[model samples]
Target: MALDKSIGVGMIFIASFVFLYYSIWVFILPFINESSFIQQFFLPRDYAIKLPLLLLLLSGLFVGIFVGKVLIKNQQKQKSKKKSQ
Candidate 1:
């Protein structure tokens, strides 16, 4: 529908903006003079790596926990079904 299409376009635009911002902050910012005004706009360069690494680690942990929970529930269901049979 029109609403869904508009939402998708908005999301895409936001994502593109974030990607461009982060890319500039990480890749291009480092090469620029540290004393320049642009440097003040971004966090310290170390965070460019640390933040993403932390996010990746946390997301992986969450995914592992989710898969474990689903597997445990599936196993429990199978055992109960077998017992009933």
Candidate 2:
């Protein structure tokens, strides 16, 4: 559908914008003068590293838990089916 296509395009645009913004904040901002106006728009340099690392760890933990849960549920279903047979 056209709506779905538009939504996908919008999402991609937003993601690209975020990627470029973060890249600039992390890789380029530090070289700029500490007093520049742009510095005010972004958080302290420490967060650029810390935030991504924290997000990565949290996402990994959630994914592992999700996979474990699904596997457990599937095993339970199989056991029940076997018992019924």
Candidate 3:
């Protein structure tokens, strides 16, 4: 259905954005010199990396499952139409 496709697309978009943001926060931030914002946010660097990583993984999984469902539904619809004709 169109709605499924839209939901899938939206989930994928959000997942991608989160993944990119997480990547930047985890990998890129380490190299940047500590600044006011950086110090305030990543102060206890011990667990700061974990939160973004967790979010990235969860969103990635949701995207995969959602897109897979859309694909399967589309396939089923096509098969039914062929059978009906």
- The model with the greatest TM-score is 2
lDDT of 1 by residue, 1-85 (tens): 6999999999999999989989999889979999999988899878888999999999999999999999999999999999999
TM-score of each: 0.81, 0.87, 0.49
Q: What lDDT score goes with residue 44 in model 2?
A: 90
Pick the lDDT winner.
Answer: 2
TM-score ranking of the models = 2, 1, 3
Q: By the lDDT metric, which is better: model 1 or model 3?
A: 1
List, residue by residue over 38-85, the lDDT tens digit for candidate 3: 655544566665776897999999999999999999999999999999
What TM-score would you give candidate 1 relative to the actual structure?
A: 0.81
Better of 1 and 2 by TM-score: 2
lDDT of 1: 0.94
Give the Cα lDDT of each candidate.
0.94, 0.95, 0.81
Clashing pairs in 2: none
Ranking 1 against 2 by lDDT, winner = 2
lDDT, candidate 2, at 36: 93
